[model samples]
Target: MTCIADANVLFSLLVEGHVAHEVARGWWDEQPDGAVGTCLLTRLAVLRLLTNRVAMNGTPVTPTEALGAWGRLGNDPRSVHVEAEPAIHESRFISLVSGRESTPNLWTDAWLAALAMSLDYEITTFDRGFKSFRGLRLRLLSMADK
Candidate 1:
């Protein structure tokens, strides 16, 4: 089965070194070659994070290293494909968050959810916001779940 990974999952694998990392790693290990996919937003989100780090905290990750990481992720034989459609289904995301009072702005989660729906791939994330998005199959990973 193919899975669309969220940015948080990728971030954990790349920087946080949290349980999500192990979960993603294990999921990758189990997938057949080229069976793991992600949305283009995921790639943009990672780049944004790296950019923010450099701009704000002055964390010194060279552009070459960042590009190498991105390339490695894309070249993985287990990666099914990376969907880059931004105009996919997104209205449902706006509607879902419009009524929530306590929910923080999670635009990336919305995009990821919509992409998972469009691609018919289960979502792999650690964020609980995904739990509220019905019809999009999700696999939320925790330390205990891992």
Candidate 2:
């Protein structure tokens, strides 16, 4: 099945010290080439989180370092970068946000889920919140709650 690396899993995979790093690595290491992909949104999220002081827990990572990590990830044969089809992506995103159960925190998740749904790519994430998105193909990583 085709899958996409969501920000949560990408962040964990790039940060060796993240609580779920090993879990992310285990999932990442086994994927066949072209089986999974990354979109611009998820890659940017990883870059933002990696460089942010708060997200890094006071340990600092420079922009250059974060970019290096980003580069390394793209080098992997298993991960291909995917582009979004703007029209369908925007349409689906709006539909999700206007859904009956929509919540403020769901904006990004909704966008990502909508993008995945538009492209038929399953999202691999640690966040169970994705369950709220109907018809999203997802691989909810197995991990005890932190």
TM-score of each model, paired residue for residue:
0.77, 0.91
The best candidate by lDDT is 2
Over 4 Å off in model 2, which ranges? 100-104, 144-146
User: lDDT of all predictions, in order shown?
Assistant: 0.70, 0.85
- Which candidate number would show the highest TM-score if scored against the true structure? 2
* Sequence-dependent TM-score of model 1: 0.77
What tens digits encode model 2's per-residue C-alpha lDDT throughout 1-146?
77888898999988888889889989988899888788888888999999988888888599999999999889888888887555688889898888467576588888888888888889999988888888898889976523
lDDT of 1 at 69: 77
What C-alpha RMSD separates each model from the true structure?
3.3, 2.1
Candidate 1 lDDT by residue in tens digits, 11-128: 6666644446677676566778866676577787766665566532567366677667767888888765564644556665666567666546466677677777777788987777
What is the alpha-carbon lDDT for the whole of candidate 1?
Answer: 0.70
- Per-residue lDDT value at 136 in model 1: 86
* Per-residue lDDT value at 17 in model 1: 40
